[model samples]
Target: MPDHPDTVLTPSASAAGVAITPTSASARPRGRRRRRPLTRAGSLGLNVLSAVAGILIWWTLAKVGFNLPTPAAVAKQAGHLLADGTLEQDAMASLRRVLIGFCLGCAVAVPVGFLMGWYPVARALIEPWVQFFRTIPPLALIPLAVVLFGIDETPKIIVIFLAAFLACVIAAFQGVVSIDRTLINAARVLGAGDLTIFRRVVIPASMPYILVGMRIGLGSSWATVVAAELIAAQEGLGHRMQSAELYYDLPTIFVGIITIGILGLLMDRVLLMAERRLTVWQERR
Candidate 1:
């Protein structure tokens, strides 16, 4: 006869013809786990509640003469801006600059960071400069960037690039260097060449950090672009906000601030989804 399921059962087993049913290792007793996953409805309801609470708080503060604009006023302003096409134009301009700078920065940062982590000589040579540059705020370079490239697309893009590059380089470097030496040794034992090991072992293991770096870089790029646009720009969200501030158009300022936050959050969500998809091998906590 084939092996009985109960044959391998631990601790408790009934006699052979007793019609014993085996308990699965995966099965858990009721209420044993600390928390249950939130349902879709529950999550949506919670988000809606939070939004309502925020609006209420803002309204109360405005009523108490805190000189703050109410949520309703901000929403109305957002609607007007949307209707006038000003918000859309500014959003597109900002998005273009950020995407270009972010792509360029990551293109350079990843390879340099990977090399630095992989080779001791590369690390010794490049790490000091990276550390030094990282210490300098991206905004602090605005003066030099303007002097060199002028208040043009070049300067704006360069500032954004610097912000992204500095953030991502460190992340990628740490990711690569933090890898399990044992894994690399095992790959070597299996006759994997340096390039092969990097491809098959290092990249996959370090991808989490790379993606994390990119996410941070994205946030930095957005923030730096705002500061860059503040310097000199024809059309961008930051430029719009600066223009609004001069006129004391609190509603428009609020619109710009909210729009940037929403866009950043959406982009972050996209990156998180990508990370989950790519790192399916990683265990979830």
Candidate 2:
């Protein structure tokens, strides 16, 4: 043992017949270091590389006798669509429906979800209907929607709304339900009221879940809007694709598919950015 209790006899020190004083040990650098995240330039380069690789693979598949249209053909079709303003009009139509439906659904869902999760009485009253509707696929409701609301924008928007609502509501409910009970108790012990605790603790804790749900709901909205458009009326990517399918226009179909994917990916990225901004206080890997 060292004469001074503050001296630590570490393994390396013992082997070298030296004592590591507390001050020296404290002054030593830590072994483990944090890894640096990718720089924006590096991340951008990687994304570009990935996209190029995907295109190369797609090109190879097209050359290998796949029925898929080549990238060039799809681009040509896209150019034609753009030249005539078909793509813009269709994209705007779809975007309008998705935005309106998704926004309204999320607006309603978050409060309802909070109520369901926070109040037992509310849960008892609301959960059964939520679950029942959730089980019935939004696509399956097309006939009912058409019959009730007619084959106009109303039914299409309603279907998209249902899709978004179900996804977000479940996410929000789970977020609230999954909050740490200890946090609430600690807040109470700190003389915090229910409203204060909820505002400070519950909402922050539940935000990640709510954001994840919103992302999912957004995807659901897009998917439902496309399918709704396919079954219903005119101007939209889904309608364009359905028309192309009848004529076996592979390039047009590919163009629609790519357009939808790109739009969805862009929207999801926006949501992801929002989530990161909102959850800055939350720890991440």
Candidate 3:
């Protein structure tokens, strides 16, 4: 009998089914090469097909006189916005604010998160404040923000900060608290101090979780940007869309929606790539 599935035995009739040679057997790459894997083009085409189906449904509803515009009209409007440069300006303005606020949010959240996780006293003191803020929607603070900071970039950026900060804090805190105690014990057994244990074991173990939290926070920040800009803003994709709505320009509205979607997709992919590169050890896991 073979010791493992990978080992094969050649049974000889002369020996009445006695095992002859239990040798390791290797399969050829022909198995993989024979399978016709789906190409990138095929995957893209499927996505395009789905989009066309959605547009067709939208067009049908529009022709039957629903509120939405047809696909062609929206495409034409997108082209016009591209040529006029309004789209570029507004999108950039919104992106700049989100980036600035996201940076501030992560900077504050990470340290606080670490503190809350590492120290019980800090957790008891800080967790309540985090919970209180997290419960409040980013939009609810708009009026207070406007009153406090006025209708300027400051207020808008503050809104973004609120959205991003609350997200990251909780994530980092949870990551640290959830670390395996066994790892800590192992490090201590090896003569590591508290600082060494935290620095070498706890931080690395918690990083994957902390990074995931930031990714979520980034999305929240972007979503909150438009809401932040919606209130008394001079320029931004959200502001532009709101302004278009006032004029009842459906095509312009479509362009704003699509622009936001595309930009969000791009940013998310960049974050995902960064996370993948930084956490390659997790992959080999």
Q: Tell me the alpha-carbon RMSD of every candidate.
A: 5.1, 5.5, 6.5
Model 1: ten consecutive residues of lowest lDDT? 6-15
Residues 146-192, model 1: lDDT tens digits: 99988879998998899999999998999899999999999999999
Higher-scoring candidate on lDDT, 1 or 2: 2
The digit string of per-residue lDDT tens for model 3 on 140-170 reads 9988999999998998899899898998889
Candidate 2 local lDDT, 1-285, one digit each (tens):
667656666798889977466655566689978899999899999999999999999999999999888999999999999999999999889999999999999999999999999999999999999999999999999889999999889999898899999999999999999998999889999999989987999889999999999999988998999999899878899999999999999999989888988899999999889888989999987
**TM-score of decoy 2:** 0.87
Question: How much lDDT does each candidate structure score?
Answer: 0.90, 0.91, 0.86
Stretches off by above 4 angstroms in model 2 are: 1-36
lDDT: worst 10-residue window of model 2: 19-28
